[model samples]
Target: MRKVNEENERIKRRYLKYLKAAKRKDPSTVQKAADGILKFETSTNYASFKKFHIEQVIKFRDRLNEEISKTTGKPLSKSTIATILAANKGFIFWLADQAGYKQRVRHTDADYFNMDAKGQRVASAVRESPYPSLEMARHAFNYMPEVSEIDQRNKALFAFFMLTGARDGAVASLRLKHINLIDGCVYQDAREVKTKNSKTITTFFLPVDDEYLTCFIEWVTNLRTEKLFGPDDPLFPPAEINVIDGAFKVVGLKREIYKNANAIRQAIKEAFTRADLPAFTPHAFRKTLVKWADTHYPTRQAFKAFSQNIGHSSVITSVSAYCPISIEEQGELIKKKKKRNEDD
Candidate 1:
């Protein structure tokens, strides 16, 4: 029993390199493609790519349908199944164009890896997700206490997320120089900040001037004066973990930025939990900002800038991705239309 297929492994490495270097795919995307290919190979008992058959594709799909999700206590979602199939489908199609395996695997057979029409529709359908409202976000500020250095940092992290609508990755990686207190904006320099698609963006502070924004400003002031953090120092610096009493504890703040957004997410969870509210992931805050813009901004021109504030290149991109109309909102819109028509 072979644990690995050398030929398939070699091809997979080349494919992943192509995905990252040529296609400019992020590490996570490339890793997912590799995982999908591994799943297919494992199902066939690590069979050689040269001995591939179309029947194997059908068998894999059937097996996937039978698989139960550990999280939901039901079968895997249509979207998950579609993703798994799509990744394999792409790899199989690409594999067909390669030497040796080309003759054995027909490029047309890769179509068998595609999801059914029903599955496709289910995968494409958007489901409503919970997001924080402006009121709820403001309410959270009350829970944040600025007692210790770490406490102030956590409070500031929450305020910063709400103010900028920044992705957690960008938040974790921002430096002092990237922020402009006077201008009221964050410069997400892609060379340093971990922005999506490495896009450089400048996000202005949202029009919410309460304790939340004040807390963030105080922290910035403290960093500049009390802490004496230079322009290169992180805005929300990493926690200094110390082995006090032979046990690790977060004692203070480090001068360095976090390697990833996990700490920032933990802070959000803690803040929400303390506020007696359901935890919203950092990315969900962007949706909240978009929702805020939709109701508040009277003109399209204002809304366009609001969209740009969250790093959206186009207004349509912001509307299509973030501002999903709720069922209640949809009913209200329809009622308004009826009233207008009746009056006319």
Candidate 2:
């Protein structure tokens, strides 16, 4: 019947602080660890961590496996389960080394939280995710209507993603000063823009269709001259909603930045829907750029430059994370190599 434990709460607070301060984990990552600990606590009915047992872990694993996701209305996925277990395992292992509870909890007890080999493999398996090709993106962009200001902004937003391969968060927080239209690059100043890991990235426009660059140029030009927006104003302003005929409608730009990337994502979805294409997330454009770079920039130096432009510190991270080879492409590459061998 107990809902909370004071002892557990004190320990959890210290643990979360350690994760943030010592481990240098981000706020979201720390929150996940907290959620994992809470799950274990709930399974044990708010029992003290000092009374931790391997049986508790077993029961928690079983419960998680049988758990259904409220959002998906389906059983929890292997990856999700694994992630939860890993978080708990990490916390328990750290707890074993902490003062006062060192005698009660053993480091080996944490091993019980791990999934079996097969489960781990299934959870970690790499699969190809959907992203638009350069040609497909161009086709979609061409179909985007540019009659109204909202339509123009939406169209330009899609093109901006393709042209710069900047992340949605950075795009949402960008100001007019961040973009260099003359140099065909975006200066993602972490102080102003919400860049990932607060990295200050300078991304040059990729050499795609001229239409993408042209569209973005017109939008920025209009923002500066026609709208009379200053450098401090939002590059892609949030929609200004007004009541017309007792109905709320997006009347025009608000001249303010989006608090998050949600609005940017909606704009992207609308653009793709209008173009009769799959509504890909703004991040998908990074994968598209990586895929294009794999074929276009064959040399190591050229590829490294391309990777750096997209905010990756190393080429390996860019290739391994984004540039997944399809089965069809893999087979064709092998066959081509065999043909070259035979010719020799």
Best by lDDT: 2
RMSD of each: 1.8, 2.4
Candidate 2: tens digits of C-alpha lDDT, residues 75-145:
99899899899899999999999898999999999999989999899999988999998887888888888
> What C-alpha lDDT do the candidate models reach, one value each?
0.88, 0.90
Model 2 TM-score on a 0 to 1 scale: 0.91
Task: List model 1 lDDT by residue over 43-106, tens digit each.
Answer: 9999988888989999999999999988999998898888899889988888899988878888
> In model 1, which runs have C-alpha deviations exceeding 4 angstroms?
none
Model 2 root-mean-square deviation:
2.4
Steric clash count of candidate 1:
0
TM-score for candidate 1: 0.95
Give the poorly placed runs of model 2, Cα more than 4 Å off: 1-3, 97-100, 342-344
- Judge candidate 2 against the unseen true structure and give its global Cα lDDT, from 0 to 1: 0.90
